[model samples]
Target: MSAYVVVELTVKNAVAKDLYSAAAGPIIREFGGEFIAGGAWSALAGVQGHPQGAIIRFPNRDSALGWYNSAAYQATLANRDARMTCSFRLIGN
Candidate 1:
């Protein structure tokens, strides 16, 4: 089954976010994942959870989890954590 990583976030440091994104993108691709949608979001109903969000599609759940847990990706966490407040969830399709 395909899998998706859904992220809801608020950026605190744009520079750091950019750097993190640059570094993370390649690793995601290497793990068979690609970003399908991202950027500012609007609330159609109820309360919005966050101002921005992203969705990454992967070949499978294992690929998504592997990308997230891989050493290369894990190394970017310190920067990502400092630059944003976010939530990531894995959804199986």
Candidate 2:
């Protein structure tokens, strides 16, 4: 089965968040995740008022979890935490 990581983010500091985004891409790719979409979006139906949403698809749940838990990704994620308000979910399919 495949998996997807869905993230809702509100960036507090764009300049700092960009650093996380750039460094995080390679880590995601290493774990077989592909970027689906990311950036500002209008809340049309669910979860109103948030301006940012991101989705990434992975080969499977294990890969998704591995990526998130890996040392390299964890390091990058710290920057994200500092620069943004966000919620994340990993969905299995």
Candidate 3:
């Protein structure tokens, strides 16, 4: 089964998020994460949802979790915190 990182963000600093996303992309890719969806939203229809979001799919839950917990990503987290408030989850089915 595939796993996904569902990210819900409220951006206060668009510039920072943009930079962070660009930097984070390669790291995510290294862990086999592919960006499937991103951007502002009209609604959140599921449980534990938010208005602005993105989804990155990985081959499995472990891959997704590894990417999320990796040191490279941790180093980049400050930029995300500077730009937005986010709620995230790793989900699989």
Which candidate achieves the best TM-score against the true structure?
A: 1
Model 2, residue 90: C-alpha shift (Å): 0.7
CA RMSD of each candidate after superposition? 0.9, 1.5, 2.0
Ranking by lDDT: 1, 2, 3
lDDT of model 3, residue 79: 81
In terms of lDDT, the best-performing candidate is 1
Quantify all predictions' global Cα lDDT against the true fold. Answer: 0.95, 0.89, 0.88
What TM value does model 1 have?
A: 0.95
For candidate 3, which ten residues in a row score worst on lDDT? 42-51
Q: Write the per-residue lDDT of candidate 1 for residues 1-93, one digit (tens) a residue.
A: 899999999999889899999999999999999999999988899988879999999999999999999999999999999999999999995
Full candidate order by TM-score, most accurate first: 1, 3, 2
The all-Cα superposition gives candidate 3 an RMSD in Å to the true structure of: 2.0
State the local distance difference test value for candidate 3.
0.88
Q: Write the per-residue lDDT of candidate 3 for residues 1-93, one digit (tens) a residue.
A: 999998998888788778988999999999999999998776646554555899999999999889889999999888888888998888895
lDDT of 2 by residue, 47-75 (tens): 56557989999999999999999999888
